[model samples]
Target: MRPVLIALPVLALAFLAGGLALTRPVTVPDTALAGLTGDAIAGEAVFWAAGCASCHAAEGATGAARLVLAGGQRFASEFGTFIAPNISMHPEQGIGAWSFADFVTAVQEGTSPEGRHYYPAFPYGAYRLAARQDLADLWAFWQTLPSADTPSAPHEIGFPFSIRRAVGAWNLLNLHDDFVVTGELTEAETRGRYLAEALAHCAECHTPRDALGGLDRRAWMAGAPNPSGSGTIPALTPDRLTWSEAEIAAYLNDGFTPDFDSAGGHMVSVIRNIAMLGDEDRLAIAAYLKALPPAGD
Candidate 1:
């Protein structure tokens, strides 16, 4: 019994050490920000492509009001309610004081300037796949937006979910910076893949997650229950969509189906964001969706 007790404590210590290692933050290389030059005009397009306003902007805001990224939007999940932080240009209430490296770390590595791990709710896993040039341009454009003095609300998460270090372990299993599909894709397909997988982060919503919240890549783009636990998010696989390429593009651009059905729910904002893209981009996205292998419900 004495020997067994000693061995048990040793095993417990070892387990604790392993968990700490798994949660360790990755180092951000200084070269990530080197030689980065950004254009505010170009950044505006990147901003829309990344769909920043969808989460950061005020709910139901329209026209010029949509540009205010004060971030009071609440996202409820099985974990708990997460309040979006203020990302506006305000020096105190927002990220105005952050440096280029800080932004890069937050977006790509899911680490804050103070070296805290961000919850996966921030979607850095997808943003990690974004091109460095695009991130630079997006940051530049974000700087041009007007600042708001709104303060951010704290997230209402509890217990295990509230422990940010636990998220590092989750990242170990789920986080990666690679494109979902591999092969010699055409130019349009490649562009669409980047837009869909990286910038737009479509899988963050469309693809169902395992119990641990990791995306089920085997069932890629197969619709899942809304993360909000409200309604079913429709599948976008070719088997389910069945729309012609033109119809797909039209739906993305105008939010209207060939049957004259209008988009609703979360898709309304998604359509609005994609509509900001050029016609070619819309067509490319449609082409990519049509080319994908179908997954069943």
Candidate 2:
């Protein structure tokens, strides 16, 4: 993980001072999003699954919860700050008129329409496992949003990371798995897999990293430091018999611990998404967790 660009002291100061107005870049909508329907309820569930508000509209911002896809939120860490872009319906600023095909490609392949590449920061790797139907629903939901004219902010990075072409190399090395949810299936298992691997993207942040910032599968979801540097994200392993499968699942669904503890950090927002799931989903995820052995435990 290198910074995407080098900066002078004055330029860096201006970026920090202007907040996010330091960079502005755009290409025509490349992903085809025109297939999306106008349905709202199903789309709402998709919204929760994608965690759109986490970066696009932060929980820390005023009206963040209601801001939906209007971009301009900032996520900071040791890597540098990543400004979330507006995805509202606004044609000039946000993604108001994108087609469903565009949305699907962007979510599953991380390829922007007209062929621009999305940085791995978008978490499209985990999202690849998303079912087309669910993705379509999400597309439908985004279409109904209030279009906002808020603009995207530029990123501040240093060195090799600054080169947009470098991301292609990173993707070639790290993005080996295209989202596929095959193998064995019970309905519960499949659903659990989809949520854990795709939309929820649980392992994207919770799994520890290797030297180059790829996932350390050996420690998968065994609790890792938050990349955002906010706080420690809890391990989701089944290490202790005491934690129990049911307890974790329930906690995910409602944010309540067996001992009356509550979800915190990025999880507070995560819980809201999990809670939107049906009871069967919550239980299936619980079953999957209980079945796992903690990494290296």
Candidate with best TM-score: 1
Candidate 2: TM-score? 0.79
Candidate 2 lDDT tens digits, 24-134 = 222324344444444668868767766777667745543435556677766665556667778788887877767676666667666676666676678877877676667
Find the 10 residues in a row with the least total lDDT in model 1. 1-10
Lowest lDDT block of 10, candidate 2: 21-30
Model 1, span 1-297: residue lDDT tens: 232343443345435745668667765676857999988888887888888888888987666777899999999877678998888999899988888788889888899888988877888898899888898899899899989999999999866566676666677778877888767888998988888888888888889887667899988888899877678888888999889988989999999998999998777887878898999998988877876768865
Once model 2 is optimally superposed onto the true structure by TM-score, how far is the C-alpha of residue 106 displaced, in angstroms?
Answer: 1.8
Candidate 1: where is the Cα deviation over 4 Å?
Answer: 1-20
TM-score, each model? 0.92, 0.79
User: All candidates: CA RMSD in angstroms?
Assistant: 5.4, 7.4
Backbone clashes for every candidate come to: 0, 21
lDDT of 1: 0.82
